[model samples]
Every structure is written in structure tokens, then in C-alpha cells.
Target chain A: MKKIKVFTNGLIKENPVLVLVLGTCPTLAMSVSVINAIAMGLAATAVLICSNAVISLLRKVIPDTVRIPCYIVVIAGFVTLVQMLMEAYLPDLYDMLGVYLALIVVNCIILGRAEMFANKHNVFESALDGLGMGFGFTLALLLMATVREVLGNASFAGMSIGFLQDYKIPILTAPPGGFLVFGCMIALVAYLTRGKAPIKKSFDCEGCPSAAFCRKEGKACGTAETEAK
Target chain B: METYKLLLKIIMTSVLVNNYVLNKFLGICPFLGVSKKIDQASGMGAAVIFVMLLATAATWPIQTYLLEPNGMGYLQTIVFILVIAALVQFVEIVLKKFLPSLHGSLGVYLPLITTNCAVLGVTINNITDGYNFLQSMVSSLGCGLGFLLAMVIFAGVRERMEEADPPKAFKGIPITLVAASIVSMAFYGFGGFVTSLFGE
Candidate 1:
């Protein structure tokens, strides 16, 4: 029961997507199709879970000041490992993902989890956190992909719907469609969750992994807020 | 003259056609995060352009002579990211020591660039596109300028959003994202047009 809470936390209450919004790049790019979305999500999840566990195991040994670099190295190692494995076996998905597969090294979700969860928790728990967040990320991607694919491409998982084929909005599958679907999905989640989830301020409130650094660097957000008002 | 046109085409393509932000979605975090103010957005954009060029210059040769020659290509991901991270740090330290005034404006953005997918994306993309050293550097410049172009344009759009009111649910990031969608759609106009400008 205790384990369940840790794993489920990332699903909705604190979804890495609709809520935290850590990895908007991959979330926006690879969600053009259901298959690509699942491929990207699971791939990032694999890297996330491995990096979380490894970082958890070495949490105590790594010095606090240099931990960011340490986490980056570990995460990059896992991303490469996953990249090569995928390239060798899943060449099609590899080609589909392009630079994004390699770009996962800098993904805020993997590194953010390492910093926020893994370093403080036990290995098992950290792994579970990774899993939960991974699921949340995948689920969000799946939702966005469904909207984009069905409406934009008039297909579901590469299958054509005869009736909808003639009425497809091709723009929904393009770059603008990616952003529009993501925006609406997030708005839907916001509407559904209402007062339950933490209120999100525009631009990198809690979701941004670099929020801490940006704040430390003389409060870029602070000044921006002042100007916005 | 022919080489110049080719390079010119590459620059125009990256800037307008294959924009890193609107089309490719490389640096959406900073795009949405820091673009509230034009000054801040341009500062970040300028810093990104600097780092993107440096990262490509550093990574292209590493991939060509170091990784490809030794048949250690698998190490590209790890080595490139580390080199970028270390380079950003080295740059920040040197700027702080040697050019404090410049660092004051740009230093805040250097650390952010390390994690920015745009920097990493442009570097890896140059290699994947089979660009030689000069071509790689040019594309990097083009990509960085494209990023800056997107940031500046979005910053202006966002400033307008500050005055406009929207629904309850679409208030924050949602509305901004929707606005971004519109802006992205507008960028589509540049497609196919670049090719026509410089005959095949």
C-alpha cells in the first residue's frame, strides 16, 4: 500500500507533464504519432529509472556541490546505453526519434528526478518514483498523440478511420498541431483537476527543472514577474 | 560564389523554414519561460547563439577525428554532452574572470544553455546532416539565429498577451501555449519559399 502511493503520485496528482511540464521538447516533438510517443516515453522512462536508481545508490558518496555534474554524467551514460540498444534493434524508431533520442541526456525530467527524488530516497523507492513519473509522462504523451493522430491524420495508431478520413484536419499533425493539442490537453487537465492540483503560474513556475538555477542567478523569474504586472 | 549561395540557403532554411523553436521544438522551456520580457529573451537568445556555435565547433571535430576515426561512435552522446557541459562552465568562469561586464549580462544564461536541448540538438544535427566543418558551423549559426528569431518574435507576442484577457482555464501556460500554436502556424508560410529563392 505504501509503495502504491509512491508509484501513483506521478500519474495524476503530480504528473510530470500536465502538472510539472518538465520535458516539453520530447513531449511536443515525438507525440505526432501514438507509436512514436510510446517509443519516446518508454525510452526516456528506461533512462529515468536507471539513472534514478544509480543516483540513489551513490547519493551519499557524491558531494553536494558537484552533484549536478555527477547526475548529468550518470544520466548521459544511461541515455547512450539506451540509444545504442534502440539503434541496434529498433532502427525504425531510432530514425523516427532522430536527435531527440540523444537529446534525452539533457531532458529535465530525468535530471530533475535525480535531483529531487533519487538523491534523497532509497534505491527501491527512487526506482519506483522513476516508474511513476515515467508512466505519467507516457500517459500524457499517449493522450496528446491520440488527439493529434486521430484529428490530424484521421488514423488511430496508423489505422485509418473510413468516415473521418475525408474530414481530417491535416494541420493538427504538423508542428502547430502539436502545440495546439498539447495546449488543449493541458487546459483540459487544468479544468478537470481544478483546485486539486497546485496552481501553475505562466512560464516555469514549478515545472521547470532549471527554475532553481534561474532563481539563483538573480531571479530572472522575479524580474519577469515584475515586468508582467 | 556557388558555395556562398549554398551556405546562404542553409542559413535561410534554418532561420525561417526549419526554425528550431516553432517547427523543431528544441528549446520550448526557455521559449515559454524567459520570453516575457524582450530584453531577457534576447539576452538568452544571444547567449544561446554564442554557445551553439562554440558547441558545434567543439563537437564536430570530436565526432569526425576523435570518434569516427577510432570507431568509437557510440560514445558520441556521452562525450558531446560532457564537452558541452564542461565548455559552458569553462566559458562562464573565463567570462567572469576576464570580462565581468559581459558576464553580468550573459553569464546568467550560460548555465541554462548546458541543459538546453537547442545547444545539444544543433550540435548532433550538424553531424547527422553530414555537414563538413564549415557547413556545420554555418548551420549552428543559422540554428542559433533561428532560435533568437523565434524568441524575439514570441516575446513580442507574449507582451501582447499580457494585455489580453482569456478564459479561466486558459489563463496561464495553456493560453500561452495556444498563442504559441498560432505563432507556429504563421511560421509555416516560410516553407517551400526558401527553395524558390535560390534555384536548385
Candidate 2:
């Protein structure tokens, strides 16, 4: 039904990392290994679901003027909760994620969902949307991590593949590799989606989460077209 | 003299070797979103530099004195973000009230900076790197300038990309990201320069 559509929307149609290009920083940073990517994805998903439900419940209580700050505080609270639990239980993953675990505070995906969906939807719907978006984000990360780990390190998960290990592309494990793999995935998604992957246009602010608050409207040429559509 | 040399090395390493965008992948949002034109790129760059410098300055002491001593390091993420959010809001208001013209140009980008990982990254990095106050300031300034440098260069390339045709699927962001990979590859050359300079 409509609920299912909302839940599945983030998996492919509106994939946060590929289509929306939200939260690219952590996506690139943590996708070097399959395990790291999965851990990061699950962590982010937990935060997203928790924050979304809470934000939805408090949507009416929080004033419009201070909603952004309120949502950030809520999201940060969840992130800290995750960080602590991970540090205590999964110390290795905790260290591996490093600064990025904390950087989740600024991950636009969480805040973006809070503003775009959670603040307006009911708790159940918001939770579903968050779950969908989080899964989409995690899926994209898994895809990138798979390619990167297989080629860069010649491994799957953490295990080494016999022959491939001898011919690993070191660059795939580096910064440039992250960008290359990410770029190609975006192209692949665009191709599969029939050139409707929300690629960068002249007026990128149109779909940007901050677009509503932006004041320089006349500058972006696509703003008018986007608005019309 | 030795301290000055170390500071110089920090600046060099941050600007080129450990660039926030190209190397660390921080702030790729604005790096891709606003780099279509030279002017807009520089405007965004300038705004980032201003905000980053302020955010780092504010967060460093808070981390050193407030967070660490109290064993509240886990609160670093929440605290730093709130600081940045408040700083951006304060800057926006001040700009609107006093410097309306400057605000008009940079105002739109200010809100975006609040969630910019680079701002938060630099603050967190300053602490984790164990830099003292002066070193943190230099590193923050260097990181900001490096971001500006990358944005300006990427802007020029994107301008040229407008004319060159690519495959339909690779036309917009995908092609741009590929180009960024090349840029990142070029930046990789500077990786060993810092260590060599220090002869370490």
C-alpha cells in the first residue's frame, strides 16, 4: 500500500547516497572495508530510525523557528548513545570508525530526513521512512565497499581472496579510489534509472535540504523550473 | 625556531597533503554542489573559511578544558555541533544586521555550513591531533584555505566540463565525481612532501 511505498522508496527510487547524494562524507570515508561499511550503515540506520520516531512525536511540540536545532540535538543524542554502546561492546569497530562515529552528528541524511519527512509525518510513517532511507544508505555503502574491498584489497568482508590478492589496485583503497568507485556507481545508477538519478544540475539547491532556508533564489537558474515542476 | 618549523609543516600538510575535501572527503557536499562557477565557488569557499576558523577556535578550548577534564569526551559530537549551529546562527544575524551586502551574497551558504562535515571535522581533528591552541588555529586556517583552493580549482574544471560532452548517464554528477577522482589523484602527489620536508 502507500505505507509500503514510503518504506521502499529509499531502497532504490530515492536512494539517499546515490540519487540524493546526501551524506557522501561518511559514505566515502567508511566504505573502505565491507565490515566497516556494514557497521557504519547499521549504526546510522539505528540513529535514523530512533531520531525519526522521536522527532515525529515531538514535531508539534518543537516550534518551527527552532526545529532544525531541536532535530540536531535529538539526532546527536542517539548518535552518542550508539557511540557509547559500540565503544563498550564493539571496541574494534569503534576504533575503526574513529572520528566518523562522532561525525555522524553532522551527517545530512539524518537531519535531512528529520526536516523533510519526520517533522511532518506520524511516528509510524516517520519510522518507516527512516528505516527505508537508512537501508538505502547502507545498501549504497555496501555496494561501494564491496567494489572497493574486492579490488583495492582483494578481499571479501575481511577474508583475502587467493589470486586477487596478488593483483590488488592500491589506489582503490585510497581517497581517489573512493571517489572513482562512488562516481561509477552514480553513473550506473543513472543508467539504470534512465537518467533520472537526480544528478547535479546547474541549480542544485532545488533538491537541497537547505533550499527552503536559502535566500539567494535568483542566482540558481533551475530553481524556477524546479518550482514549476 | 623549531616550533615555527613545526607550525609551517602543519600548515603545509593540512593544505595539500591532508586536504579535507580531496583527501579526507569532508565537505564534498558543497565541493560538488557549489563549484559550477568560479565566483560562486569562491563565495562558498570564503564562507567555509570564515565559519571553519570560528568553529575550530571555539571548539578547541571547549574540548581541551571542558570535555576532556570532565571525562565527557563522548559528548564531543553533540557539543561541537551545537557550537557550530549557534555560531552560524550568530554570524548570520550579525551579517544581516550590520553587513547586509556581504550577507546577501553569503547568507544562503551559512545555513549549509552548519551541517558541513568539514567544519565539524576540523574541530574534531584539532582535538584528536592533540594540537595546542596556536597549532589548532594554524591548522584550521590552513584547512580552510586548502578547501578554498580545491573549490576554486574544481570550479574552473567544472566550467570547462560544461562544454565537453560525455555519455548521457555520466553527464552531470557522475562525470563531475570522476573528474574529482582525477583531482584527488593529482593531490596524492603531495602526500609524501610533508614528511620529506621534515626529513622524518
Candidate 3:
């Protein structure tokens, strides 16, 4: 039950990009094409998952004063590791993502999770939070990419489908198009779900019997306010 | 004469032909954030230009000496961000201690520059464009001035926009975005002119 809740939280309820509004910089900049979006999303997810796991395991040892810097070092370490491995293995995706790959270290999402959840949680829960949040981010990227690529490039996932291929809006491919499309998507999501029976987020477990353990799983905590409202 | 041509090229490229805001979309956060007021727009622009120039100066040596030779190229993002963050902090402290007046003017924006992609973008631009120290400095200056130019111009437009009645849905950010689109199209006019002038 707990695991399923964690997984679904990232998909819809506590989506990192849409709900939390974290990591807008990369989400806005890199979603120019479907390929770039996926590559950026996957790279960030890999870093987030690994860093969260590692931070969870070492949560006890890292002092609070240096926690932010410590997480950065860990994140940067994995970022470098992922970057080199990508360059060596997936040279093509490496080229596409280019500098943005390294920019993931300041991505806010990874560091946000590290500070907010991973540093406090146990290994299992932290890993779940990472997966859920990572997937949530990827989902947002894909959503944005779908709009940008479909309207701008007139194709989805590289295939020239339907009348949309020739239906190129031209502006959608450019910079302003990225912002306009993203803004609309965000508005739609907010309008639709803002007033719905809000999904009970996990972080609400505070003062409950399992607060200690669930604290590690940060997903539940964020929606607590909404749940109360 | 060669240096003059490079300077001319940098100015032309950075201003209209490949504007940091309209064309490259580098510093749109502040562009959108602070451009509502003309005075604030220029203030933000000047601050950005100043920080950008200094950042280019600082990051160039760090890249040349540290990242390339050590094969820590992969660490570029993390290293550059840390350097920029630290630089912003240092500048804030120094301003508070020495240039209190200037600090008061720029303090609100100092913390904002840490995440401004344009700062990082310019440094990254130096690396990828293979710009040496001097050229990078020139490009940074050009980019900053271009940012200033865009902000000032947009502020002028927005000042006028306040008087005009607009649709409910597109009143605030939406209309500003539309105006940006128009400005972006206007910038496209500079492309051909700049290319012809440079003969590139």
C-alpha cells in the first residue's frame, strides 16, 4: 500500500514540476524537442535516484550545518559520474543534452529532494521518493515536450503523425513558444486539479505513529497542507 | 584593426542579431521579473551586466587552468555554479562592507543572480565558443548591454501597456509574453542587417 502510494504520488498527486513548481529552469529551457526533453529527464532521474539512495544511507554521518554543501558534493559526484559514463557510452544523447547535463547539479530538484527528504529518510523510503519524484519530473518534461514538439515540429516522438507534421505553428519551435505552451499546460493542470478532492499526500504522517519512518518518504509530507485545506 | 573588427562583431552580434534576451532567451527571468518598472529594469540590467562581466573574467581562468587539464571537464556545471554562487556571495559581502550605497541598490538582485541562467550561460558560452579571455570579456559585455537594451525597451512598452485595456486572460504575464513575441520578431530584422554589415 505504501509503495503504490509513493509511485502514484509522483505520477499525478505530488508531481515535482507541476505541483511543487521546482526545477522550472531546466524544464523551460531544454524541452525544445522530444529527444532533448527525454535525455534531460532521464539524466536528472538517474542522478536523483542514486544521490537520494546514497544520502539516505549516509544520513546519520553528515552534519546538519554542512548538509546542503554535502548533498551538493554527492550530487556533483554522481553528476560527474553520469556525465562521463554518458559521454563514453551514450555519446549521441551526450551531445544532445550537452551542457544541460552538467547543469543538472544545480537543478534544484535533486538538491531539493536531498535536503527535504533523502537526508532524513531511510534507504528504502528515500529510494522510493527519488523514483517517484524523478518520474514526476520526467512526466512533466514529456508533457511539455509533447506540446512543444507536436505544435512546433508537427510530430510526436519523432514520427510525423497526422496533419500535425505540416501543421507546424513555427512559433512553437522557437523560444517564446516554449514558454507559452508550458504556461498553458500548467494553467490547465492547476485549474483541473486545484479544487478536486486533493490526493492525501504522505508527509501528513507527522505526529502519527510512523512519523519517524515516513519522514524519510518526503512525498507524503508536501500534500499535507492541501489535505488539511 | 583586427581587434576593432572583433569588437565590432561582438557588439553587433550580441545586440540585435543574436540578442541574449529575444534571440537566445538567456536572462528572461529578470527580463520578466523586473521589467515592469523602467528604473528597476535598468537597475537589474546594469547589475546583470556587471556580474556577467566579472563572472566571465573569473570563470575563464578557472576553466582553462582547472577543468580542461585535469580531465574534470564533466565537473564544469557543478564547478561553475559553485564559483558563481560563491562570487555572488563575496560581492554581496564586499558591497555591504565597502560600497554600502551600491549594495543597497543592488542587494535585492544579488541573490537572484545566483540562479540567473544567463550568468552560467555566458560562462558556458565562453567554453563552447572557444573564446579566449579578452573575447569572452567582450562577448559578456555585449550580452549584458543587450540584456539592458531589451529590458529598457520592454519596460517602455510595458509602461504604455498599463494604460491600454487588455483581455482578462492575457492581462498580466500573457500579454507581456505576446509583447516579447513581437519584440522577438522585431529583433529578426537585425539579423540580416548585422550579417550584411559583418559580411559573415
Candidate number with greatest TM-score: 1
Evaluated on chain B only, candidate 2 has a TM-score of 0.97
Candidate 1 vs. true structure, TM-score: 0.96
Please write out the lDDT profile of model 2 over residues A1-229, one tens digit for every residue. 9999998998888898988888889999999999999999999999999999999999999998777778889999999999999999999999999889888878888888888899889999999999999999999999999999999999999999999978999899899999999989988888887866555533265445455455334444323223322
Candidate 3 has which clashing residue pairs, if any? Answer: A121-A216, A201-A220, A202-A220, A202-A221, A203-A220, A203-A221
- By summed lDDT, the worst window of 10 consecutive residues in model 1 chain B runs over B104-113
- lDDT (tens digit, per residue) of candidate 1 on B27-57: 9998998888898889889999999999999
* TM-score of the second chain for every model: 0.98, 0.97, 0.96
Per-prediction TM-score, chain A only? 0.93, 0.90, 0.83
Off by over 4 Å in 2: A196-203, A206-209, A215-229
List TM-score per model, in order.
0.96, 0.93, 0.81
For residue A88, give model 2's deviation from the true position in Å. 1.1
The global C-alpha lDDT for each of the candidates, from Candidate 1 onward, is 0.88, 0.87, 0.74
Best by lDDT: 1
Off by over 4 Å in 1: A205-207, A211-229
Which pairs in model 2 have colliding backbones? none
User: For all candidates, what are the clash counts?
Assistant: 0, 0, 6
For all the predictions, what are the DockQ values? 0.59, 0.57, 0.14
